[model samples]
Target: MRTTPAGGVVLVGVLAWISGVLQLFAGVLMLVAGDHPVTGWLHLLVGLATFPVCLAIFRARVWARIVLSVVFLFEIAAVVFALTDLRFLATPAVTSAVLAVFGLVLLYTPSANASFRQATIDRRNRAATAR
Candidate 1:
């Protein structure tokens, strides 16, 4: 496994922490409050749980990409569903949708791929040169 640079590590850490907090709050709201939340709290909980996956990405954990990708897909579906049902007008669904798409873009872009590869390669090269 390749180690991420300090800056990348910090970025992932902050993202993971913030996302986890948001997920937990959202999940609890859906599960424990309101007459009728748009969705189940379990989804929120799962999202929160998956927050660590984002952090793992910086560490180049293979599973992190797969998991985050799945989360983004789910967010896209949720956005589509909300828009179709006119729920977007009632809540922050549109904003959430936009954020998810942004994440998707980041994950799928060639730049991100190249960056990941470069990071990995650089780490290997540096390690080899050190020896």
Candidate 2:
């Protein structure tokens, strides 16, 4: 059976994709500017990795929720670190923190929880039927 995606999932997926693209652009720019090659490559790798997670989230995969939760937690921690250092928050950091909080809240909402649970059940049913 086909299931409709929760609004939260869609929102998170879109935001994640946008963030990933921006990260990829920043990585390329950093590389061209000849600064921090390691950081630039790391950013490139992260950007490329986000696509599959976004796709999984869009598909309502259970593992996607876990992955996203971990990612958001890291984003929040990074934001806190930046704040403690009294560093000016860049656009990406600010946006990431905001989106990370919003996404986490959405994911934990009652409707979103139900959607995820239902997706899990559907997947299990499908697997059982296939067997």
**Candidate 2, lDDT over the whole model:** 0.70
Error of 1 at 88 (Å): 7.6
Across 33-92, the per-residue lDDT of candidate 1 in tens digits comes to 433456535447546765767767766554576787677567556545444444424244
Native-structure RMSD, model 1: 4.8
The residue pairs found clashing in candidate 2 are none
Per-candidate RMSD vs. true structure?
4.8, 3.4
Best-matching candidate per lDDT: 2
What is the TM-score of each predicted model, taking all chains together? Answer: 0.60, 0.76
Deviation in angstroms for 20 in model 2? 1.1
Candidate 2, residues 1-131, lDDT tens digits: the string is 76777898888888777766655654565466533565556546666777789889887887988887877676555445334332342355456668777888887888788888888889889999999
